[model samples]
Target chain A: MTSEIIIQAIVTGLMMGLIYALIAAGLSLIFGLMEIVNFAHGEHLMLSMFSSFWLWSLFGLDPLFSIPITILLLAFCGIITHYFLIRYILKAKMLIQICATFGLSIFIRSIAQLLWTPDFRNVDKPLLEGRIEIGSVFIGQPQLYASLVCLVAFFGLYWFVTKTETGLALQATAQDRHAAEILGIPSNKMFAIGWAIGLGCVGVAGGMMANYFFIFTDVGINFALFAFVAVALGGFGSIIGCLYAGIIIGLVESLGGLLIDPSFKLLYVFAIYLLVVIYKPQGLFGRY
Target chain B: MDSRLEFAKSEPIWNTNNRVFSIIAGLIILLFALPLFGMNSFYLHLFIMIFMHAVMAQSWNVIAGFSGQISLGHGAFFGIGAYATSFFYMEYGITPWISIFFGMFVSAIFAVLIGIPMLRLSGHYFAIATLLIGISFQVVFQRWDLVGAASGLWVTMTPEDSWFALQFHSSKVPYYYVFLVFFLITFFLVWLLSRSKLGYRLRAVRDDPQAALSLCINVSNYKIIAYVISAMIMAPMGSLFAQYILIIDPDRVFNIEISIIVLLITVLGGIGNVWGPIIGASILVPISEYSRIYLGGTGGAVDLIFYGLILMIICIFRPNGLISFIPKDILERKKQR
Candidate 1:
């Protein structure tokens, strides 16, 4: 392959990776706080994408303009999911917790199908149309904006979790719920906040992707699989690990698709995931 | 305390073991006689599906419930079994009866290869790895030209009915009886395993691997054994499914939904118990069948929603499964009286 083509692939892969990082950030945060892997997390992204698409189609609002609305909506959804469904099973068996989320995923997907139908929907005349050419390389406007938004969101989340007192409380709750409770952190409320932030990240990703990608009930599964790989590859609860792992996965997927058959791209991603899981279960940056 | 003492002192009206045996015998007799009553093909197909799902769920229970290894890629083994038998039949004109064993052996080998590396990861990591493994298998098979690629492979129909070929010309009765035998064998093996020394070791590993390791139990070995056995049992079911449907596809056999369905059935019934899968399949199959008939094209969505609700409700209200809700007091009272 030519150097230019490789560079192009890397750029495209990096853009895709940023969105994946956004989706996986929520999953990692939730896992860190409650030790519960949200199997239905992908569905939340799907719902947000649909939300963005509808806002664009019905009100002529650009997907870029609907980002804040989608984030808030998804954050509310995260809160409701935690309050009604997840809270009760917090102390249940591992299988129960996993199956509950898996069921929720099915429920959300089916509900979307029932309400909006399964036909692929896209934002018409998105604000970021066309591409920008820089010397020998060109980047799609939608992808560039999406990556920029994702980069900002990632840093914003990192700052919130590390700098703010509320963020420290969330971290403390994740580290030791009993100790945090003794310190008057209100573990339950912290958990709820974690869900909101985590899901809100996915909401941002969904809105951005809605500008460029097709929207459907099952679209989340396609992206969610990658997010799962990214999170697992990055270590379960490490935000920085998730970011780097997401990028690695995206590059592998894009380069593998170019080097090998496109159909085998997913195979390469899974191969890397399996290898990492077997050899480095703690991930590259994870302390545990 | 006084009531408990009095209960212990009471004489039993009947032998509990004998009564249980009689109930099972009566149920088996009923099952056998149903085909003779000229039931419709649709109900027969439904019962066959129930038996198939029950077997699949029970096999999953061995690894997930008994050994504490949550595998989300069991459908890969099932697909292996289906493809093994289908390919054997299509290419060498081998009968499914013999090729079913080939499928089982292949699945067992595959299980060992994957289980060794995968079982090293604990909890959610193992689950996610298995899920990806299952997906990768689907992707490879979809792109593979040897197995007819995405179009899938079909079992050629013989002109005349042949027992050796595992095909029937006229009725679904043969299929039901064949599946009944499959169900019985799987059920019997699970029952026997639950009461055996190996079962105790598996339970020990599942309950606490660290404790099991301290007690000198080879945790990984037992887990691999459970996984291989589960894969072997599931493989035949895939072969049976392919034969029943007369078609096999990467998506149909290797889909993540297949693995999820088995997981759901086992969880709904009560994991680790021998009878749990049967009870779960009995409840779930009918609901799905009826929903499909009543709801038509949107039936899939309705069923998906219904299953999701059931799973959530079960997780919250009855995490031990519906089987646990059975009144122990009633059985005890009948025996004591």
Candidate 2:
């Protein structure tokens, strides 16, 4: 492949990687707060995309303009999910916990299919329509904006987790729930906030992605799988690690596709995940 | 022991009671007699599917339930069995009776290769690894041209009803009986395993790996054995399903939905017991079959929505599963000494 093509692939990979990082951040935030991995996280992304699509299609609101709305909407979804489902299974067995969220995922997907009819819907003629050309390389405006927005949101999440008192309390609860409780950090409230912020991150990524990607009931599965890899690769509970792992995965995906069969791109990504997980079960930056 | 303590034991005591045994024997006889009463093909097909899924779920229980390794990639093994059997029979003109063994053997080998490396990871990590591995198998099979690529392979129909060929186009009755027998054998073997020393060691590994290690149990080795046995049981069901359908496809056989449904059935009935899958399949299969038949089209997803709700509710409220609802008298005939 030409050097120009290689540079182009790198740019595209970086963009996709930003989005993957944002999604995995949400997952990692939740996992860090409690050891539960939200299997419904992909469905949460799907819901955000659908929410964005509806805003654009029905109200003529552009996806870019609806980013905040999607964030708030998904945050509300996170709260509802926490109160309605997560709270009940908080102390359940690992298998039960996994199944509960998995069931919720199936339920959400089924409901989406029933309502949306399973046809692929696109926000046609969105505000971000054209591509930007820089010398010999080209980047789609949607992808570039989506990635930039994801990067900004990811940074914001990092700031919130590190700088804010609420974020510190959330982290404190994650470190040791009983200890945090003894120190006056309401574990339950922190958990609820964690879910909200976690899903809000998904909201930004999903809203931006709806402009470029197809909106469908099943679109979240592959992205969710990738996010899982990113989380595992980065080490669970580490936000910055998600960013690094996401970029690496994106680079591997695009480069693998460029060098080998495109159909086997996921194979290489999964292979890397298996190798990393087998060798370093604690991940790149995991504490445990 | 107090009555509460007696009931607290995870293992049901009804197995040793001749009364419960007679009841179970009577139920089996009734099930066998149903086909003779001229049941329609649709219902016969439904029953066969339930039995097939029961066998699959029971096998899954061996690994996930007793051993506590939740593998979400069981479709890989199921697909391997189907693909291997179909490929051998279709290409070499080998009878499915023989090819079925080949499928089981291949599945066992793949299980060992996968389980040895992946099984060491615990909790969500293992589950995700297996899930990705399963998806990878689907991707490979879809691209591989030797197995007809994405379009899939068709098992040729026999000219007549032939036990040797494992085809019975004339009647669904034979297939039903065949599946029923397979289900019985799988159930009996799992039951026997539950009582064996290996089963105790496997349970120890599941309950606490560290404790198992402290007791000198080869935890990983026991897990691998359970996983391989589960794969062996799951493989033949795939072959039987292929021969019955006379068609095999990567999407149908290797779909994650197959693995999920297997898990749902096992969890719904009971996770850790031999009877769990049988009970789960009996309830879940009928609901799914009836919904697909009646609702039709995308409306069939209605049952799946209900399935999701039921799974969630069960996990939250009755994680012990519906087996816990079995009458106390039927469950325990004698208190522990």
Candidate 3:
């Protein structure tokens, strides 16, 4: 590939990495605090896509403007699932929680499929049509916008965790739930917040991702696998680690296609994951 | 060994409930014979699929159910077994009878490599790690290029030989008998395992690895052994399944759907119980197959919804499986009488 092609590839990959890191960070936070893997995580993203897609198609609202609506809607659904279902199995074995969420995921995916057939849907908004050229490399308006949105959302999260009392409670729960509870942090409410943030991250990511890939019931799986690998590589439940791992994963997917088939990207990701777990069972930045 | 046998005899063969099992067993035999009367290929295919799936779920129950170490990569082993036999037969004209056993051997070795390091992890680590491996195999198989790459590998071997080819064309009856043989073998294997010292150790490890280790059990060894045995059992079943379908594809064989269905069945049927997956496969597979007829094309997700609901209910009410829902005290009373 030429220098221009390489630069463009890197830029595109970096943008993709930021989005993946955000999605994975959401999943990591939920698992970090609540110890639930959220098998329906991808489905939540799918839900947000359907919500945004429908709103835009039906009401002609701008997709970006529907971001808040998607976040609010998915957060409400996430809270309900956590309270009615995941709350009871919080302290149980992983298999049970996995099945519960796994089932929940399929259930929701089925509903999405029922409503939105596996057809590609797109929004041709004027705001998303332009591009910015830096030197010889080019970046599309949507990619740049999505990347900016991801960075903004991430910083907002970082600020909330450090400055806000509730955000502190969420972090504390992840550190030590029992200790947080003893400190009068109301661990349950914090978990609910964690769930909301976890899901809201997915909502925002989905809204942006729909700009790149078409919407479908199973569309979430493509990103979900990447996020799962990123979390495992970055160290489970570590946002910083997810950021590092997500970019690495993105670069691999783009560059690996040059060395081997693009399909091997997943295989390479897992192989690296196995090596990490074997060599550093606690993960790259894992506290556990 | 003698002392262990005496200890086993003192505890009792089964934990009560003779009447119910006998009735259930009788019903199963009748159900197995149901296709004999109908001669309907559709129902026969469905029954055969149920048997193959039951065999797989039962094998998974050995590790996940008895030892509580769930591997999402079991689908990879299933794919390996099927592809190994089909490829060997197609490439070198090797008889399937021999290739099938080799397939199990290959799967067992694979289980050992992955399971040795993985089985030590507790809870979600183990599950997530296994999922990564499953994805790994899928991507690797697709890229190998020797196996037709992403388009998927297919064996055009004719279904001519009855015994050697493991293929039949006359009617679904022969295939039904073949699957029955496969299912019966799996059932016996599980039965023998659950009654043996190895089985007890697996249960102990699953219940609490720490406690099992404290008791001087080689927890890691036993866990790996359980995985190998489970993988071995599943491998041949995959070979049989591949032959039955007369086509072998990575996506079809190694689909995450296989793992999901097996896990759902084990969870639904009452894992660790010998007949749980059979009960699960019998109930769920046919329904899923039938639903696909009505639910396919337009983003059909009905089967997924159904399977997910069953899994959730099981997790909430009876984590030990449906068998746990049975009143233990009543069974104990029946045993006393």
Candidate 4:
């Protein structure tokens, strides 16, 4: 491959990594706190894409402008979903959590098919339509904005998680929910909040994706797998880990796929996953 | 509390009164008599599909229902068996029946490669990893030069040689009998698993890995074993499917739709029950098939929606499954009374 192609691949990978990071950030928080795998998390993202699509169609709203609404709406949805099904598995086995989440995926996908049907929907006007020319290397306009938004979101989340009171409480609860409860941290409610935030990120991602691509029911499964692999690679519950892992995955997907076919990229990722589990296990940034 | 505990601990006492058994027996008898009644080829074809799906569901139940490891990529092994046999038949001129062992072996190898690290993930990641494995394989099969990529490979062997070829042109009877044997074998395996030490170990690990580990259960090894063995069972079914359909495609075999269908079956009949998948497939497939036939081209998402609603209801109220309702009181008696 040419140096230009390599550079472009890295740039594009980094940007895509950011998008994965945004989704993975909230996902990590929920897993860290509640240990409930949001099987419908990707569906939430899928729905958010639909929301953004319709919002743009009806009201001419920019995806950037619709972010807050999507986040809030998804937050509410997450809380409700948790209350209804996930919380029951909060104290249950990992298998229960799996079945429940699998069911959740089913429910959400079905509902999505019902309301929107299976037709692929997208926004026509590109959020990042133009591009930047850097000598022979060119960057898509959307790619630049997506990376920027991702970086900003990550930094903001890191700051808020470490610096703020509730953030600390969230962390403490994740570490030891019973102790947090004994210390009067309101673990249950905080977990509900974490779920909301986790879902909010999925929604945000959905909207962001809508700007660059189309929406469908099955769309969530691919991203959800990315998030799961990212969370696992980054270690179970660490925010910083998810961010880094997402970026690593994004780059590898680009560079590795370029070397081989894109079809073989997952084989590489799964290999990485196995290596990480056997070696680091705690993840590169996993909490001790 | 004892009764509630019993309910939680024991299988629901089989209620002989439930017409579910009679209905099942009646259906089987009807099917058995259908060939004797001079049935047309269309009905025979439908029966073959039901049997194949039932066999699929039963294979899935071993891993998902019993082991509590929700592997969404059961289709991977199924595909492997299909492709392996097809490749062997075309290239080496091996009998598909003999080649099935090779298919199952290769598929099991892939399962092990997947099962080791992935089995550690347990719930969401386990399912996601399995799904990714299927996706990866789908991508591999679609693009790999050897398998003919997305267009897929077709067996060059004609089905006309003899009865020994395991290929038939005029009748669905062979297909139906093959799937019937598949169903019985899978059912027996799951039944045996339910009563065996392996089953106990799997359930223990599933219930609490740390505790299971504390009890000296090698959690990862046991889970990996369950997953790989389950894959071995699926391979032949895949081989059979490819032979019957005479087509092998990545999307057709390794699709997410297969994952959902298996999940829906286990969920509907109630997870962890022996007959759950059989019951679920029987109930859901006809509705799904009819909807597809009736809806024809336009809007066939109704089946998905139906499953979604059923899953939600199942998950929320009857978390144990549909089987729990009929068997609850009996189990309660075993535990509490």
Task: Specify the highest-lDDT model's number.
Answer: 2
Chain A TM per prediction = 0.98, 0.99, 0.94, 0.95
DockQ for all candidate structures vs. native = 0.67, 0.69, 0.59, 0.45
> How big an interface RMSD has model 1?
1.5
Residue B313 lDDT (model 1): 91
Which pairs clash (backbone N, Cα, C closer than 3 Å) in model 2?
none
lDDT of 3: 0.80
Instruction: Quote the lDDT for A210 in model 3.
Output: 59
Candidate closer to the true structure by DockQ (higher is better), 3 or 4: 3
Please give the ranking of all candidate structures by TM-score, highest first, separated by commas. Answer: 2, 1, 3, 4
Task: Give the proportion of true interface contacts each model preserves, from 0 to 1.
Answer: 0.70, 0.59, 0.66, 0.46
lDDT of 3 by residue, A155-192 (tens): 67767777898877888888988998999988889888
Worst 10 residues of 1 chain B by lDDT: B328-337
What are the lDDT figures for the candidates, one per model?
0.88, 0.89, 0.80, 0.77
TM-score of each: 0.95, 0.96, 0.92, 0.89
Stretches of candidate 4 exceeding 4 Å from the true structure: A113-121, B1-31, B39-43, B120-125, B157-162, B210-216, B328-337
DockQ of 1: 0.67
Candidate 2 per-residue lDDT over residues A47-94, each given as its tens digit: 999999999988999999999999999999999999998899999888
Residues B259-280 of candidate 3 have per-residue lDDT tens digits of 7888899889877778788878
In terms of lDDT, which candidate is stronger, 2 or 3? 2
- Measured with C-alpha atoms, the lDDT of residue A36 in candidate 2 is 88
Is model 3 an incorrect, acceptable, medium or high docking prediction?
Answer: medium
List clashing residue pairs in candidate 4.
B2-B336, B3-B336, B6-B335, B142-B149
Please give the distance, in angstroms, between residue A29's alpha carbon in candidate 3 and its true position after superposition. Answer: 1.2
